[model samples]
Target: MDRTAAPGQSHTTPSTALAYLNPRYWDERFSEEEQYEWFKDYSHFRHLIHSHLTPNCSVLELGCGNSQMCEELHKDGATDLTCIDLSHVAVDNMQRRLLSRGLKDIKVLQADMLELPFGDECFDLVIEKGTMDVLFVDSGDPWNPKPETISKVMATLKGVHRVLKANGIFISITFGQPHFRRPIFNAPDFSWSVEWTTFGETFHYFVYVLKKGQRSSYEDIPVKRFEVPHVNLLHEELESEDFAFLINVDELNC
Candidate 1:
């Protein structure tokens, strides 16, 4: 949660080399004894999720790391919940965790978000927290992504769109701002209503609610500006270590 790094300051390093793009890189990371959750826990956004979620809805969490979001959701009376990740280690570990809790109802699968294996209109809700941000990091530069990177990110969204039932919601919690992340959700063929909420003072995080089959025309979109109070969320020295390349400071620069 450290936020001292300047805009676009977080960059890929040799130690974490290609970890954003390669599944093997994540498999090795998840294989280690230590466990890490990308950002804030499920409690922070549970109300938002619960507000839109209906009883007995089929929920799919994309890139569900070692986080307890799925377990907590299952405990909160959500049945038919499925969690997926590209790393087998992540999937296996989550499965064991659920088994230990005697929660065999929740399904954990090793699958790629880019090419989802589900049938069309299979899920009532699809949630992603920081998964799309990781994909943006792998796309070279966040401000200006390469063609293939944009395609990959769009393809992932298309997959999500295809699998979602009519009027289904796709909630994304990300460090990316409106300007950087809005375009991806505004594709011509896709029909989605994008609404965002920003949290935190100096270092902000966004929760984007995308409602499928509810398209908001480009002209109707409004410009948003965020103001920082010049306060530090983390110690200056721990900024680089804490952020780990996923935090985007572009808003701070602007």
Candidate 2:
């Protein structure tokens, strides 16, 4: 109800923001086969990681909804995998989908990303799709509580940083602009750099390939460089935010 509570309001506290957000609401929405289809169908993300992911790699799919990316990854050669979702109903459906195929290496858990039940650096790769965007759409304005979205995501990123091996990677996809930026003010202990820009009409998602330690091994996927026209907008008028590039993964590694 309170949108403009304050800038830099503590979004990390589970009680403060996440408590008000309900996973059941999301579950009800995604319960439909159509919703499941949209979330699972990720051509862009798959294109980015198809070369990097290999078999026998332990992968963690954060916000693993009623999607098949995890299933596709398993089909592609991944052996050990852990999929987590905020909704128990969604997780149950995911498990059933895998079970129907006689797959056994996947484990689905109903847990909040803000507070996961896992150790540090435990995964080789962490994947997020449609999860962050959902949060922005769900959180009401007036308070314009989207900053909490950044805080929650960074907390999840911090968790990814801790569990991933030095060579491990994290990839997240969200909708926004080219130079779009949000405040990750809560995570001082973790050092994660990002490279995200606009792609397609009305869809600009960043592929955050986060790694622990340093950027010694991380590299951006080979691609051409391009820029989109800047549609200047006041921060207040935009329901969603967008921006331009400051750096890329290659630049960070160098």
Candidate 3:
């Protein structure tokens, strides 16, 4: 796997996009790969995400694959942390890995992010690195994504929104441009301020900082209505591209 690839990057030519949405694929991969980082390693984003962390803050890491983020954070003194992933292989591997490293406070669980099995206002900070971008993996048309794609992203993000305490921070790092992602973060139902900091020089990556309480009017942004489109993009794209994260860099400036 090419770790240098951009966020929402298609893995390969063999319909790898759909596989990312499936847990069995990840289970098999994790059984073999054991360790991998979706985007840059923990050190790269530490400056961008670490500011939100505190030694006592309760943190939840969604879709925590083999990424060593939680472990590194624990080493940084953030002990109260929970990491969840759909891949049981990953959960087991992480459990053993952290234990061998003499870290015991971080809890790694096999759970779905779409339906976060937690009570309301439980976490101070929820973070995900290239996780939600998986929802857009099989999404058709970077411009007009399928309703199913939008629905998955919305439901999962809404779940994240629900588990956050008042003024809780959600740090999502991705290659999704502000125009494409800000609307979902600033959706009317979600009371949050969407502010993002950019990273990566060649292919820009975004660290979207969403505060739980502030609301944005979404002024000057074309918020695409999440209505059903007439065309069957899934039916159309399955024949051609294995994944669809291809967007013009010139068009997306932070």
Using TM-score as the measure, the top candidate is 3
Q: Residue 46 in candidate 1 has what lDDT? A: 72
Per-residue alpha-carbon lDDT of model 1 for 122-225, expressed as tens digits?
99889887787766554554556768878888999999999999999888878777776786777675788888996545446688998998885662554454
Native-referenced Cα lDDT, model 3: 0.74
TM-score rank order: 3, 1, 2
Off by over 4 Å in 2: 1-20, 38-40, 138-150, 182-188, 197-202, 215-254
Q: Is candidate 2 or candidate 3 better by lDDT?
A: 3
Worst 10-residue lDDT window for candidate 2 reads: 245-254
Instruction: Kindly provide the TM-score of model 3 when superposed on the true structure, using C-alpha atoms.
Output: 0.82
Q: Compose the digit string of candidate 2's lDDT tens values, residues 1-254.
A: 11121233211212212222565455564454322433225564567768658667788888886667788887777778899988877788788888888987799999877776888667887877656554443333312344665566567667777777667776765543323332331135555545453334443455555555553223332223346553334333231231111111011111
Question: Which segments of model 3 are wrong by more than 4 Å?
Answer: 1-15, 217-254
- Write down the TM-score of every candidate: 0.81, 0.66, 0.82
> Candidate 1 has which clashing residue pairs, if any?
7-249
lDDT of 3 by residue, 1-254 (tens): 12533344332323434666776777776776656675567887788877788769999999888888898878776789999999898899899999998888889999999899999999999999888877887666666677998898999989999999999999998767776787677767788888898876544578999988876565335565553323323422432322224221112111
